[model samples]
Target chain A: MNPATHRHPASYRDPAGFVFEEDGILYRQIHPRYQPSYEQLKQSGLYDRLVSEKLLIPHEEISQPNTADAFRIIRPQRIRPVIPPFCWTYNMLLDAAIATLRIQTIALQHGMILKDAHPSNIQFIGASPILIDTLSFETWIKTKPWIAYRQYCESFLLPLVIGHHGVPDSPKLLRAWPGGIPLETGRTMLPLRSKLSLHWLLHLHLHARQSRQGDTPKSSSTGFSSGQMKNLIHSLKLGTTRCHAGNKHSGWTNYEQQVSARGQYTSHKLAVIQKESAALSGIDTILDLGSNTGNYSNALRNISEKIIQLESDPQTANALYEKNKTAGDQNSLSLCLNVEDLLPAGCDHGLIPSLKSDLVLCLGLLHHLTYRNYIPLPDVLNLLAQLTNKYLWIEYIDPTDPLIREHFNPERVEQRLIDLETFEKQLETLFTTRYHTQLADSSRRLYLCSKK
Target chain B: MIHLLYLDPGNGSYLAQVIIASILGVVFYFRNLLYVVRDFFYRLLGKKDRSADS
Candidate 1:
């Protein structure tokens, strides 16, 4: 078996097809059993409608099948910086549930239904959540219950309900139950107040009880009108929307408002960063470390096409996600992550999309890693250098800056270099400075450098 | 649905949704009936007619 071509780890559950990557490009191979359904998907006009509406990721037909068991192969339009479902904020997950139901609604109208409904089937591109799996649809048999009903409830409704009840780290629970939260476990975890609502009672509480009893619809009528299925899905959508994250804590979400008060300093810093970034060419991919509400990333819109904003604080990341979503800014991807975790030794870079950026912006984040995390400065620079392909735009903050004083102690800060002499000496070893400028009224400074 | 093909849709969820959806089907049936009645009255009174529930 050549190592260059291998099946995606998570694609084993479904027998219809599996995802594989060859030389870092992803493709899906449809098994011979699913050939009929794949034909119907296109011949019925469902594929075209879904693609045009942006509800599904569009794929191109590759005439050559890669394996003996495969009947067809397709290359989907890949979305970058693949984020794990466990890390999604309350609203991100909620929007995913709605998008899933919306796709099923459209599918039902086209004489088909989703054979599987799970968060794993969805991927967010910019602010929009799109279904990536093309093999999930099957003919909608009138007598058949939405065979994926149980899967949908467990996958979407249960998680949303758990988050709604303010369970601590509910999103993290997805890591344990990636195959959709176990209905029994989720039912037990839900609060008593949840039973008060009709939709919850029917979908979760009552559903779990029946499952426990092992009740099968032996002689009972299993057929309901398509209208009823649509009605049920509509109810799920309404219920899912009501489930809120409700656990936003900390001041980082409001960091931008506080920084705006120091307008003289911020304006100057942004101006220099923008001007320096504009001077550099061929910067298609950009990464911003500690992007509090993505102010700096948003300012660099004209310079780069794709911006990856990494923010550790969940509330602040959600705020940025919400802001970008509302503005319909499809060019930016905001990921909730700790900066220290990304650019360090033995860090599991497997879960995130590859971070081989052309230009990396490390503004105002170096001091925090050095002072709070106790990491050496040279190692941080080395990690940043490895992450970017060409240029690095890093900032150096002195102990006197008010922003640094908020959470860090200036008097005991011995790990960071206070003087430019040591700072430049440490920096010049890896990158040659292209331009350097000091903010108009502050001791903070920005540096634009390229790999030597 | 459970006896059908490769995917396992949980038995309890299938059973529960059957009962709820059947009840909903009845509710929509009556809703459409009411709409028909209302529309008939509107036509009789020379008022704007309404469409049946879909």
Candidate 2:
């Protein structure tokens, strides 16, 4: 509703095109520099084919007759709910990676390639991954090796191998190196035995060596002919097919094997909230923030009509989606999303975004915001309060909690920590704290609040 | 294992299994309660989570 508060970085990648929102509808404005590529994308019929097939988001070309600065602008068909990679379950991420590859192969056929390869560029729409960046296409370079290879590896390959293969902390690997993980860094993380295999050897080992060769004929004369292009597509299709839901690690199956509530702490905390939530009548939907596998969603099954669990971990979200989808619980939907960049759908403009939920749960999620630049905790509470018209069930992890400290680095107990009073002051202004309970040790607290 | 491995090669084969499983996972993601019950038993019996292994 507030313009200053709503503006998102128009996907900060290229220095050229910029994304802007007008009346809640998102439109991308391309400068004169990218005119050639934009022309090629439309004239080549790639735009029509992709949009019709639903591989790419559909956009409308806007031309105003009276304006002097007639810049080429496109308004893409917006997604109802925009989710981030962190919120995806493992399978969802895999699907996204596959979709990106498929899009890349299709672009190559049209003499174009994706200039950037950030996972955030892709999002899930109804169990299928959709490439959201309509501007990623550019005229292909026949002589050069795929320039976006390293990024693909980092944004797509690294997370997949690390999450499904043995590395449980693969997601952290990307978090540490926002720019695609360096090849050498990836090589170091992989076990010595993996280097002997061809896929790892050529892609990871030799690829890193080639990168260091700096300007050593980065482009080869080799180009994919019509037949060879088909083969490449087939190869990518095969690669995506191999990457599937069951490809989880032992740790993933028993994710809490290393971490539990250290006694009956989790159960106690959850039970308290359940008792309070069950008492509320005429409530239909409950949004479970940071729902780590739908455990909390189970608690409100009695009184709540539908429980939507939002998780940041791609793998966890995928697993939760699969679990809930299987039970045919139409009332329950799990989506991967980042709470930091919360946007309300259905703006004043033509942007038909997803409808905002009634209730919101921010359990065990606020601490992660500390890692980024100062996201004033009050601002976050304010945003949550703004989006919801009903009750809010929230949780705060005690500063003394070891897991909280470990997950968040530098252990800035001073700059980041939000005491009970500070947090209460932020929320009490917008809503009154109706019920509060200390879950498990003194680390976890659950509060049920009503709108003022 | 014999039926799957013999039909495909390279990473392509991995995807073939994955696509099959994905379709099945979507179809079965909500319908059959018996699958989860069976999977729970497998998990208890030390059957590794091979859902993504394809």
Candidate 3:
């Protein structure tokens, strides 16, 4: 492993571990202190088999001639895309949860258990999720209760359940508190029927009580027998099945009610997109940011090879993922992402993260940033301009437009309005405005800007 | 005035379940001139179910 070019984020938690990038590749450096567990991981043949099966990324043991840290560094394989939890669609979260359970089950068979269960440790490669933290596995201790189970449930399971149960903002709530929701808070929000259930009663409510148990520690340190561990893994599999069953599918389901767009207006807007996008060829990949219910995104697929329909709302995004999955759409994909907190163009700083887009379809998202979020119009346009490569497809709604007015009471945000002319001028700076026209009587203007 | 958001399966997420519930609540409580406009508002927003039954 080359340490000269390696950059380690000092803020990373693990003391015996540090991440480094060598030769445009990212790798986790396991220290001498953690070598015993690492060797056990390799000696047991768990690492080789897992990597061969693509259950885990494989890494060759590279020797680093570093005398400073007094520990040899081993470079393990790395996942290219390190997506944070907030970027995941509900289905991705659900899958990651199942993947975690699967890994835990596999680890138990290898006479090991994962010490960490943070959702951040999981990453998505294509649609499949994998456990990226190689060091999370440790020698199995038969005498301790599954301490990480509750933590894993909190980090992965609860937010998914809450989101599916109509608390659309559950991810945000969980995001706000990274340690996962306090059991007390979950107890308050969880329905009474859930509280009465055996899992909730013991794992959640009782666990909370045990945590609150002052002097006397709550649960004894008695470990599960090998058979019990197997049973526990089976129970985890059952939980994953239940979680998957509970996830409802639909695109931005709740958000559609919040926005006001007449059918005529939406159709007209979509027609303009179709007309503009149809002419472009070899430009197979299209990204429709803020794609609610994927109405327009669904149209773009006829022109492009694949459409990545992204929406921020969980309910909506979840719906989108399910729809495409059920439709057996091999070309179109949907994801949940707040436009502002978009997955960065690249994961690591120096190395290119390989998110190349041929076209960007940004429609009806202007008011969301400008009026609702109080972001300046120029700033919103600037961010959109950065995302596009060859062609920029966009729609701009008149600030005084009825649809815009309904979303934001003009009474409160009079100054927030930006006329079409002003927006056009800004686009002229970076993009050659190729397509610009009003759609129906909605006062919505569509613009197709070619990179200047 | 308070909106109850209903998140469910099969409904095109075009209408977040909460806004519909809220609009229904509004029409039930305040039967006035604006109620017609409110219905129009919901319809225009595509919140009014076109195919799927609530």
Candidate 4:
């Protein structure tokens, strides 16, 4: 078996089709069982309408089947910087919920409905969320209630409401319950005030009780009408919109202001970055470390195809993500992540190295890793080397710098760095410097290095 | 509807769903009825289809 044509771990649950990559190209193989629904999706014009509106990821049917059991094969454009549900901001989660509702509405208009409403079925390209699961649609039966209703509530609505209530760790709940936060679990966790709201009472509280009692409304007459489904969708949209994270201050939210306060230093740093980035070539993806407000990555927007901005603080990362999304900068993806605990080996169900970059940009982050995080310089260099495939743009901060001093004790700082020569010697083990320059009137030195 | 009621298990959940569906069905039926009634009068007065004209 060719390793390149292996099936994705998350794609196995859906028996209609499974996603596979062949020679770096993603393809979906539709099973023979899904032929009827697939034909209905196309014949009903839902597929064309959705593709035209960019609500669904468009695919081109392959002429030749890749495997013998395949009823049909299709090639879909790979969306980069794939993020998990837990990392999404409150607003992003709401956007996802709205997107799911929109898909359901459109599906119903075409005499179809979503078979499942899991967050994993959706992917964000910039701020816009697109449904990636083509097989989620099935011909709507008036007698059958919305089978995915409970799923929608648990996966999208519950998480958004939890986040809106000032719980920042709402997304983490997804890790524990991959199917979604259970209805009973959410009902218990939500505050008493939430129970008073009609939307919450009907969807969360009553729904949970019904589920616990093993009450399945399966009979034809007991099934809800299309009108009721529409009403439910409307209520869900309004409920999701009302759930807000409310303004809460965090440390890195005002990082751009601090940088601007050092007037000359900011401009000098920007100029140095612009000059160095302009000289680089053959770089498509960039992994930016400590991308506070995405200042450096945003500067390289024209040159890089995709920029994955990794920031430790959630507020700062979310602010940058929202800004990029609003501007429709499709190439930039901001994520809240600490470099100290980069990518866990097997956390995302065997989807290893979620984001890989041709080039890495580590600007004003060395001190944070070495001083604050207590990561040795050699270990830091090794991790950066592993993440980047080709080039690295790293910044070395002098011990004399105020930011470095603030993060580290004076004695520890002295012991760690010792001298500039020692730091350069450590970096030489993994990467060779291509371009090195000291910024004007600043103790920072920027190096454009390439893996040896 | 009677057959459906018989087939369903004697559970309150199905009954609740039936009630909710009935209410929504009534509202939807009336909402469409108003438009149908309006169209009938318009045609009776020898007027063009208001929906098509719009």
Candidate 5:
């Protein structure tokens, strides 16, 4: 490995190639073993067709890496602020699964097979999820059923089934359980009647039973025709589409809808954001931390070229994703996870934590971190300073905000109330206040600050 | 050429897909054939089956 090249930790699972970045440009180095598959993918015209259909990310063959193990190094087009599978809502996950199956079917027609169906392989470039792993395809063998049948089940089918039963955290659950959701785990999660359904009986219930019994009495590889493969994929598609009941969450779903009904209090905040953002030019990226319902995200969309929203609630993120899809917003990236849980202990974060932006938005979130999360006010500002490259639009709600009383810690909440003057003094340590104001008829104060 | 290291396609699951797909393949094969036949008749009768291309 090159000293400057940092291999992505999650990329080690796939043997064909691994993604690494050198000087901030992402590259996928194809191993010598995967060269044949790569050649077949190109010569067979499968790569071209898939790229033309926009199902696969297009890449250019760059100069080979400076390593003996490397056969080819290609630069795949970048997807900003990659959102993981755990953050995806049921609908987004299902859509990704369907897209995977569709790509598999396409690959089959071109005499190749999609060897893996990991949900993380798909990223939302816009409203549609696209396959980012170019080396996921391999030449089809005569009777090789699917090298990744179990992976498809554990990663997509079972997760969707669990989500269909009104479990919103199924994707997160699957991610937590390691390689994929265990068959028995998925089997137990489904209701008894699932065994009656043909799709479930084959893919989940009996599949679980088959997995536990070790070697099936049948031969390891049996006669599986191409038609049978398509039929199996079709069945998986049927299972995915059967999941339609949307999951709803308690927090902030109706926040955007009520923005107009809240009258002066909300309008004043929006007016302030509009006036400030409208004056800015050539703003490259805007990061909205703690984006609940994209209420403020929608306000800042026109001024910035790209918007990255870090939303905690899956359902809220899912709702925002669906709204973006409906409106056809191509440059929006919504990541769903806890605001403070980005880099958990003993987990993957060597790359994810590097996300920052030119202008960072921290609207209406100070009290939640201070009063509710018990995070020191200075620490929050320090973190915000790290994320913000040039400008920051943050909010500090006064002690009288009625909403602050919901924290339930009467003593703790009162002690942590960061008043207007105190907030300015602390913020001055990191950012110079270019502008500041108290919203009319509301206990909220807004600040537009730039780094000193 | 197969790599020295490749993803472990669980033996049980690989065998199960063949075993189960063999049976369900017959079911869905005929099911797809029946749809084809139905679509053929619909086309002859000048009424387009909405699922003809599905």
Candidate 6:
């Protein structure tokens, strides 16, 4: 092993291999115990098929120093800015469930089976979901039932159904129970109508009852045929598709409809963004704060190499994600997160930065942070300074504006003394103003600033 | 005589999946068969609901 290589903390659970990083590059070390399955996976052409179909992350073998207890070292194409389970939207979780079924179906076609079905094994790159765990495949036995069946039900099936049934907090269930939500817990929490559905009755209610009884049939891998396994996979696919199709629209699903209410204001905002963004050079990554339904990010899509759309609302984030998926747009990634309180521990055990951006956009978000959230103006500026290494494009809304007055208390605003002059003075401590423009017929102003 | 059974949670879940999936497969086959038979009788009698054409 290389002396500088560091093993990721989350990679400790899997015995087949562990992911390690060496000098900014991520690599997976395959154990000798997995040599047979790894060879079979490649020789059977499963790896090539999955990669071509964009279902799995592609990797290339690398000759590293470690040789004693390792069969090989492979480095996969890193999926940047990984979105965690807590940050996933309802449709995003459903998309992940569908992707898991697709991976299992493809594996079965190549005479192999997925040994595990953990949600962490899958990550979204833009709108598409890709399997990140390369060692999850194993040769299928003749008569054995799928070992990952229960895990699939808990992690993918149950969560999708819960989210579709209007539990916006379903993603938190995964965080609370990493192994997966307990079947008995799911049975108790699901609505009465859910039990009447045949899919739920079989997968959740009966499964939970049987699990509590602890009844095991005799082990027989000999009688299970490939056709039977295919049937199981098909049933799971149908269940997941039904869940995804049944997702009900909630808060902020139609947020874009309100943007057209102020046609001139929106047009002017777009023009300023396009003109100011044109001045930036060598821009690689962009972080759009409060990216409600990703309208501005979609407008500036051609300006940056990649854009991470961060929205605090799950419904709004999912609306953007569905659009991205339909367009096959690989440049924009949407995540559900509260910008005011980002958890550093959640970012792969602090191995990666919680947020990275070459240019940060704070359009139509500062007033809410300062007035609604009560975060001080200087502190908000400082946070933005830490997030971006280069430029910051921000919008300032006057307290007297009709939109601002509706949401703020006049006495509170007067008490805070958060005027534009005070804000500009505070902003100067962290960023030097490059350009400023005032919107037409509004108390709104856009500023382009560089970190001081 | 009554027999008591004991098994770990893992094996128990696997057994449950096998049983449920097998039953579902058989039920689906029969359900499809019933639909096919109903359609056959309708065709033989040359009787179809007016709403079906719409």
lDDT of each: 0.77, 0.61, 0.63, 0.75, 0.77, 0.77
What is candidate 3's local distance difference test score?
A: 0.63
- Evaluate every candidate with DockQ and list the scores: 0.24, 0.02, 0.01, 0.08, 0.29, 0.13
Docking tier of model 6: it is incorrect
lDDT accuracy of residue A228 in candidate 2 = 35
lDDT (Cα, tens digit) per residue for candidate 6, span A225-263: 565677777777777787753444555677667667765
Candidate 4 on A1-452: residue-level lDDT in tens?
Answer: 23224876556666677777777888888888999999999999999989888899999887866566788888887787567766666666777888888888889999999888878777788778888878888889866666677777787778777776667547667767766787888877888888766666666677677667555535435656667767667666767777766564587788778777665777887887788778888889988888988888899888888888877676677788788987889888776666776633324322225666888988888887787767788878888887888899888888899787775788777667635787799889999999888877688888889998
TM-score of B-chain for each predicted structure, in order = 0.68, 0.32, 0.29, 0.47, 0.59, 0.59
- TM-score, first chain, each model: 0.89, 0.64, 0.78, 0.92, 0.91, 0.92
TM-score of chain A of 2: 0.64
Give me candidate 1's interface root-mean-square deviation: 7.4
Q: Against the true structure, what is each candidate's TM-score?
A: 0.85, 0.59, 0.71, 0.85, 0.89, 0.89
lDDT of 3 by residue, A1-452 (tens): 55534645431566556677677766566666887788888888888767776666667766664656525565556543344565567777777788877778777778888776766667665566677777777888775546466566566666755665566546565456565666556766666666544444444555555445422232334323555555555544554455543435343465555444465776677777888778876786777888888878787777776677778777677677677767767666666666765423322212112234678888888787777877777676666666667898878877677756666867546777677678888888878988788877677788888887
**What TM value does model 6 have?**
0.89
- Pairs with steric clashes in candidate 6: A143-A221, A144-A221
What is candidate 1's lDDT per residue for A135-171, written digit by digit as tens? 9899987666777888888878898898788752465
| Collision pairs in model 1 | none
**Candidate 2 per-residue lDDT over residues A223-294, each given as its tens digit:** 323343333344434544554444443333455555473778766767787787777767766777667767
Instruction: Compute the lDDT for candidate 1.
Output: 0.77
Q: Which whole-number lDDT from 0 to 100 does residue A343 have in model 5?
A: 33
Q: Pick the candidate with the highest DockQ.
A: 5
Q: Show the colliding residue pairs in model 4.
A: none
- For every candidate, C-alpha RMSD to the true structure in Å: 4.9, 13.3, 15.2, 7.5, 4.0, 6.0
Off by over 4 Å in 4: A1-5, A64-68, A216-221, A343-352, A407-418, B1-54
Ranking, DockQ, top scorer first: 5, 1, 6, 4, 2, 3
Model 5's DockQ score: 0.29
Model 3 DockQ, alpha carbons vs. true complex: 0.01
Give the range of the ten consecutive residues with the poorest summed lDDT in model 4 chain A: A343-352
